[model samples]
Target: MAYRRTPAVQARLDAQREAVLQAAVVLLAERGYGGCSMAAVAERAGIATGSMYRHFSGKSELAVELFRTVVGREVAAVTEAARRESTPQRRLAAAVETFAARALRAPRLAYALLAEPADPVVDAERLVFRRAFRDLFAEQIADAVAAGEIPPQNAELTGAALVGAVGEALVGPLAAGGRHPDEVIPALVSFTLRALGGSHDSDA
Candidate 1:
């Protein structure tokens, strides 16, 4: 059924969609995806269960949209945070801190983004996001190599390794009960720098 709306109605609909996403995140965080229900999400959004069906067809679509919404925010924030840092190491560090801090700020959202799996749409969206971050790291590594700050290596390989390392290093700490992000970011930065053949000034 086509649910066309006036401009004002459209705005309200958009707002309702965001609320659904938020509610879905809460549900996924509190109860794993298998346990969450569309009716529950609708209730959380303060909308009737029937109204949510107008926006999302099923559990998969709702979860995918939530994945896109929450993880997209993290990816965008990380990209923005690392924009000023030129060195590959610093850029990698910025990326790590961005993920860690954001994860802590939204633990359930972070879990849904990193640890949990969504539908096929979510998987495709995640792959696109992962590649974007990989490209960003590759660019930084290229710059660092150009400046003679690091050993020469294939940018893609280097980027993949760093991205993997970042995920491995931060995921546990971010998810660890009672763990704070500020404490982990510096350690993460230092470790990644060393893994990248250490900085130029470190040996002196």
Candidate 2:
């Protein structure tokens, strides 16, 4: 028979896991994936190196969890930004602007999430992260087409392309430590608007 954890023990494990994740976030922001070894995270969390195994099977597992934690917050932020907008075209612009602005604010972490070389597991998570943004863009593109804000187009393809374009556009600046947000963000928003074949006057 398998033994079950007591309520107190389960709560303790939950808190420890959160601490481990928090420590990993700090390390990822500072050094990208290369700096997030189990030992380093354990030291940061003030736990034994062996204790990390209690929360994660290995580094790949920890890295994937870390990616999800950070990406979830980003997705929520952009989603909220888009929700506050009054039009499909403006929603798309808001999403792009918010994502670029936040990424620029956290360049090292953004570089890791956007383009860092990492474990195969982390790479797979990156695809999921990209798809989440792709879906968000596709939804607005479809809405825009329905509202006649833009010409009819394949929403999925356009969405995927936009995601790729935004990622590629930001990679250079993010990797270079992203010094020029005021210039970079507006330029990106304009490019996204033109790609969607929508008016940028209101977004401006």
Candidate 2 steric clashes: 0
- Per-residue lDDT tens digits for candidate 1, residues 1-204, read 898779998898888888888888778677656546899998888899999987999887887777667667777888888886666567666776676677676665555555565567766766766677678778777777777777888877888787777766666764664177767766666676776775632331
Q: Give the TM-score (vs. native) of candidate 2.
A: 0.97
Clash pairs detected, candidate 2: none
lDDT of 2 by residue, 89-166 (tens): 989999999999999999999999989998799989999999999999999999999999998999999999999999
Task: For each candidate, give its TM-score against the true structure.
Answer: 0.80, 0.97
Model 1 residue pairs with clashes? none
Q: Report, for all candidates in order, the number of backbone clashes.
A: 0, 0
